[model samples]
Target: MNRFEYADNKFSEIEMMIAIPSFIIGVGILSLPQALASATTAMDGVFSILIAGGIVTFITWAIAKFAASFPDTTFISYASLIVSKPVAILLTFLFAIVFFSITAYQVRKIADISKQYLFDQTPVEVISLTFFLVIIYAVSGSRVGIIRLNMMFFPFILFIAIIVVIFNLNWFKFSNFLPVFQSNINDYLTGVNKSLFSFGGFGILWFYMAYVNKPNKAPKMAALGTGFPIALYALIFLACIGVYGESVTASMLYPTVELAKMVEIPGGILERFESIFFVIWIMAIFNTTAMAFDITVLAINLVFHHIPKIKIIFLLSPLIYAIAMYPQNLIEVSAFETFLNYAVFYYSIFVLVLLFVVAKIRGVKPSE
Candidate 1:
């Protein structure tokens, strides 16, 4: 790709397939077991994960179809045609805030976990600042650089997830998952709602599909990408339940992290696995943060075309840092995350549906 091509576009179907899952499976994975356990039984959580995954996949496909309809144009561009330019600008800024909010959540959560598991003596301010620096460096380069980072690190992410599951097999009890369907309709609804929110990151496809080499293939690639996190979440949920029981998993703050703590290497190859796990897991979180940051910059650039991306990234870093540090403690962090959960969910539906309906009404044809 030449400079012009690289500047204009940065993703292919395969890169997108890798990027979507990498974006989706970040800090949320750490708390997924607790989220699922709180709403339903161990077995019920497994079912809820699958159900929620399917729903999210369909929503993402819908967003992809909307993007495909306006090939070579981003949500920010087409939305202006559907609505007024000022309205699109306002909504774009609002959505950029949402993305920034998630990046904040990731940095805060990663810092919290690092303090608890890996750096008991280190200050969270120091850890978060360091992590933020890495995120800035990742986003400073082309979006293609970030996409390649995801593609390279994805396997390590999977390896750690599978290793966590495999190493916990000795503690697994079949009876822990017994008495399935113990929860009522309300319980299932609550569990599915929580699980469904974890898949919120897929909404990035709205902004990203415009860069796809084959925009026509984006829906299928995105659908397949969605499946990775679903299967990974289900397996992790099952593993947590089998090892810790539903009650225990629900009570614990980070059940998956705890699951890593439980692994006992026979030869004492590495005494502490959770630290190793967190090291790998933090990179996955970085992928999530960088993608969110990149989109926020992209959104801003859509309105102010003269600003360079590098400068925008530098200008936004402090605001993101401030947001990440705003939460005083874990309770406040959880409250913020819950707010983001519902916000992303409803906002995504509104944006996708509005675009699709307006496109049809306006006779916006899908490109050849």
Candidate 2:
């Protein structure tokens, strides 16, 4: 089999739009509401959502524009073509480490949440390892297979998640959303800045655009991908804020899960709706972990001429597992998330700067 057999020029522009955002938005959606609540009051959460989503949308467009400037060349390839080989290699390494670390962190969070809420008796290591294995298997398939897998799972997850939200509508208190505009404008801006981390996955399009059949329209497709998540996240954020007071939502680690707990079907067929929600969430998290792992693998393959003899998935899995196992408690996990925000912020800067330098040196004009 070819080393990168999945790297086909087969995906339509709409699929590109769907697959890219679906991959990025999965895990991020779970924590975004709490992140906003902590940063500002419940009412201000709306503004935060809008500002963060808007900023992420702009950045996605910029990256898409950069990618489209060089048709048929991946970001790894174009970095070398535009900049010094050494610098390109350095950037590629940075990209790899970023994605790898993100994969580790997300896996760790999933394991932690599962142990806390679902399987109290099962060892955390076992739970996490099993989850990681499933992701590796999914990612090892062809790109088309992965895309189809995402299409199959995304709607079900969304449906379950929305049902949970809708069921909790009666619990929503307008009083919970009182004192609108009570928070300072600066507080809302800071919330927006922090919330940007929730949208970090949109950057994956940088690598994906090269393989798209209609490379010329990749920017528009990418924008569509970015928009989908923004809309979905904003709705969820509003729901969480509307249902629970700002203080209560801010205090909770995963407000979405809390929202799930509040869900009540008329028949009471399920006493614990959160458990059912967890099943769907596991699939969503698996999709994200697989996408992150696949992108990292592709970047490495592009940078190095020699494909290593070892199974790339097997080799990387243990390293990611080890990283996931590092955080001993939720405090440590929160610290790591803070570090991730800074890391992603710098990485975004790196992309923008790298593209600017490349365009200046290559005399490439901005896309028309």
For candidate 2, the 10 contiguous residues with the lowest summed lDDT are 1-10
- Candidate 1 residues lying further than 4 Å off, grouped into runs, are 1-8, 366-368
Clashing pairs in 1: none
lDDT of 1 by residue, 120-145 (tens): 89999899999999999878777888
Residues 45-141 of candidate 2: C-alpha lDDT, one tens digit per residue: 7788788778877877777777777776777767776776788788877887888888898888888888888989999899988888888877777
Query: Which ranges of candidate 2 are over 4 A from the true structure?
Result: 1-9, 308-310, 364-368
Every candidate's lDDT: 0.87, 0.78
The clash number for model 1 is 0
Each candidate: RMSD: 2.2, 2.6
Q: Report the Cα lDDT for candidate 2.
A: 0.78
TM-score of each: 0.96, 0.93
Error of 1 at 43 (Å): 1.7
